[model samples]
Target: MLIYLLKRLLMTILVIAVTSVIAFLLVHLSGDPAAAMAGEGASPADIASVRETFGFDRPIVFQYLEWVGRILSGELGRSYYLRMDVSDILADHLPVTATLGVMALSFALLLSIPLGVAAALRPNTVIDRVALWLAVAGQALPSFLFALGLMYLFGVYLRVLPISGGTTWAHFIMPSVALGYYATPAIMRLTRSGMMDVLQSDHVRTARAYGLSSWRVVIRHGLRHAIVPVVSLAAVQLGFMLGGSIIIESIFSLKGIGYLAWESIQRADIEVIQAILLVIATAYAVLTLLADLLNAALDPRIRIS
Candidate 1:
């Protein structure tokens, strides 16, 4: 297990390095950063000065090495537009995103698990059909559109929730619902499939033959076995939620990393954009690693590798 964990950690490091390099290069590939900063009206000397100051005049490799070194030493650089430390900006906004994600994920699990289990218990029935339709719709709709419709129904017409912004629990309603609903389809499908498979397994039949109560057989045998896959699915979905929050956050005007990313992109703030990409990528990597570790813990066969 220790060796397995060490190997995963090493792999995580390599993945992060690759992600950082890709993100950095992709941002540069679009055009000259200095030219973008200068906009359409800047003189030749202005562009040259901006280039020299930002080290655009240096070799790409040198710039990459220097940026990596600074990042390693806890310097994320200043936001080109805000003129503030990137770290400080992220620090202020991280909690809001994290909190919103937690709320959304919790709601998704709460909604999906029960619906999935019910669907599995009565396959091909009305409940199962309903669950299937929900899963399909949830997967099909874009989160931002869902957010807008929710805001209209629940916030504008009903006046039960806020239309935009995430200030309190009330403010979290629309955004969280949109995020949770988007995530539910994948989780529900996984849970339903896992549970259905477990229900048909020989072990379940053996438990039933032993005259165990149906609920007892399900709770003890079916749920435990089915949960392993569900947990893994949930983890991957949670990681996706972090990235998908950008659209939802933008619609709601929430002050999260997603909102920050949107703002940075509009202004072409390279430092903020780079830092946000690195942060989001690192988050996804860490969450995926955590999921892998959890999967290993849940399945002994996995830990052996």
Candidate 2:
């Protein structure tokens, strides 16, 4: 297990290294950062001043190495538009997105796992049909539309939840539901299928033959094996949530990294854009590594493989 973990960690570091290069080059490849930073109608002198000031006049490789050095030193550079330290901006906003991602994943797991287990236990019955229908609907529905519906229902009609801002937990409820619902279908389907396969395994049948209660057999023997894949999926989904929350954050007026990304793009803040991409990519790689370790813990076969 230790060896397996080390391999996964090394792979994650390599992935992050590749991602950093891509993030650094992406803005440079688009066009002159100095021109974007200087804005329209700027004179040639202004552009030159901007370029030289930010070291954009340096070789691309030199710039990249310097950027990496700053990142390693916990400096994310200054935003082209905001003129503030990128790291400071991220520190202020990262927690909101992180919290939202965690809440969204938690909601997905809490709702999907039970539904999947129930559906597996009662195949072809009404409970199974309802769960399947929900899964289908979740996948088919657009998240933005779902978010709007949630806002209208709870915020407008019921007036129980706030429609915007991230000041309180109530502000996150609709956004979390909207964001989490997109992931629910895949998780539910995987869980149901895994449970169905596990329930039919010889070990599960032997556990039943030992006169264990149905719930005990299902929860203990069945779910233990069935949930391995779900752990992997959850990690991937969480990374997606953290990176993909821009639209949700914008709609809900939440001050998170997602909203910050949107603002950076509109303003062509290259430094912030690069930082956001690198941060999100690093997060994704780290989550995947953790997932691999968790899967190895859950299923010894994975470590052996």
**TM-score per model over all chains:** 0.94, 0.97
For model 2 the TM-score comes to 0.97
lDDT of 1 by residue, 95-152 (tens): 8888788889999999999899999999999999999999999989887788888988
Q: Pick the candidate with the highest lDDT.
A: 2
Where does candidate 1 stray beyond 4 Å? none
**What's the residue-level lDDT of 46 in candidate 2?**
100
- Candidate 2 Cα misplacement greater than 4 A, ranges: none
Report how far off residue 304 is in candidate 1 (Å). 4.5
* Residue 80's lDDT in candidate 2: 63
* Candidate 2 C-alpha lDDT tens digits along 1-305: 77878888899999999999998898899888898888999999999999998899999999999989988998888986777999899998999999899999999999999999999999999999999999999999889999999999999999999999999998998999999999999999999999999999999999999999998899989998999999989999999999999889989999999899988987889889999999999999999888888878778898886
